[model samples]
Target: MSDDVTQDAVLIFAKRLGEIIATCEVSAVWIDSREPCAWQYIRRDGETIIVTCKTLQYWAVRDAAARNGYRLDVKPDEMDVMPGQQITRGIPHADKLSTLAVTPYLSGNSETIFRSAWGDGSEYPTLRRMLRYASTADDLGRAGVIGKTAQEMYGGPLNSSSKVQRARDTGAKEWRALSASLDTARDELIYRSTRPQKDD
Candidate 1:
């Protein structure tokens, strides 16, 4: 799933996610449930941006920067690359979002990407798979991490509840431990994407 397939799946996923969030927000209004949300939380460095979000939210931003493209490096599981930073160098595009909940470099690295579900880059199972594909058995041993997959960590993929709980825990812990590092983010706002609807 590394080539066009992975890319296409991710594109469809982000596009669909944007739509779902918008729809859920809209539906909320029908019952007077809650006000619509138009922003996301993000952290970044010079040419890198890290978003600690549910899985959907992370893919919402990436390197490609086309309206729906993200060229991710998918770094090694043991590179100490920090959990969530794929080094995306720009802001996101969202028709709905007015602002992004921005902090500074919370993880030791300036660019980190995190998923509320997996707690760290342990969310990146692909990195491990790629290693298995490219490396000799000895190389894997040298690499040290077989693959700290989210499934391995939590017994299975996360659900909405798990994601919420992890995000709360990670956000609090990181904020407490790394508060001093939260420097002035560049003045910017980001993302709420919507694919154009077809004229049925």
Candidate 2:
């Protein structure tokens, strides 16, 4: 009911959440405080992350080095987008003829991100630059995207011939680099599976 009590509750919840996420593979997790409009962002990859203010939760865990802290009262730095996820201007809904159209009129950064994979705005170059972005079918499935793997998205790896696939491929160099990069990502970062995996 009181502000202190509410803060204490959030602190407790954050402590528990950190402990739970530590043992698994996670792209990002966060806590938002509506009162002050503060957010605590946690991410394992190279993406910029902020877990501000070292709340009671951080002190509870007593591991300052393990978490990156920011002051919620100040302006937080820009954060790279979460892996296996993309921002959309809107919902970018699949229209009535969405599935039937080959080069359907896809708009918005949300739709275009998937549509322009191989060109100047393509994702392969983006993925190559990231060096830490990765996901498995499991992760994509969890993200609720339509296709799970590059194969499912395009047809097969190293073969970016499909319309949706071409939107992401860019050129031979970017394509090859992305393929190898994803292979390494899938190999080194698999959370639960025993064999190598691939993802879109």
Candidate 3:
């Protein structure tokens, strides 16, 4: 068979396997990359099994299993460790662990931003400054600011055209209510500033 045909068959098989696993009551699924590339799926019954890969290390597999609340029956010594593979006792075996050839699919691009900020060593100070500014703002002002910021960040209200409009439509509730109080304070300050002082 040609390489393209083999790849298509593998893709189909993987999709079917994923569907089957999804239907099963699995507690967690862990992709183990230590020693032998493998996958470990722990069912709700606490039964744990490992799928071994010759080219990946299963070094962190134990920890991953524990984190997912699985307790494997086999001990470390029971693993058959070879140059590029590690096999656990009493589990189904595959001829080539074909899944290893599949590329990992990361869900987002946030890692690039995170790595860039970390590499430049600016994230810590930026976060600290933001925290300080937030702490210094008065409760009412802080709430208003945070609400406005969130509105802008998330494209206004979940169901409205804009957050400000949403606030007005909703009777200026919660943080928006503070706007009236602020206006009153400003008017009082202006009146006091313009008034003549009494003779001593």
- The lDDT of model 3 is 0.41
Q: lDDT by residue for model 1 over 90-199, one digit each (tens)?
A: 33443222222223212222343223222442433444333444465556544423232222334444334564455445445645543323332222111112335569
Off by more than 4 A, model 2: 25-200
Q: How does model 2 score by TM-score?
A: 0.15
Q: Between candidates 1 and 2, which one is better according to TM-score?
A: 1
- lDDT per residue for candidate 3 within 1-200, as digits (tens), equals 22443444455556545654554343223345322233554445675443333211232343334344434466445334555334333333333323322222121223443343344434243333334446667874545544453354456454344655543344335324334444454445445645899999
Cα deviation of 95 in candidate 2 (Å)?
30
**Every candidate's lDDT:** 0.38, 0.37, 0.41
Best by lDDT: 3
Q: For model 2, how does the per-residue alpha-carbon lDDT over 1-200 read when each residue is reduced to its tens digit?
A: 22443455467667655664554333222323222211233344434332223333443332221233322234323342355332212122222222212111111122333333334435554343322224433364354222223344455553344632443543455667655655454333332333566686
lDDT of 3 at 172: 33
User: How does residue 13 of candidate 2 score in lDDT?
Assistant: 60
Candidate 3 weakest lDDT stretch, 10 residues: 100-109
Residue pairs in collision within model 1: 38-97, 64-71, 83-121, 84-112, 84-113, 85-112, 85-113, 94-192
Task: Give the Å shift of residue 192 in candidate 1.
Answer: 26
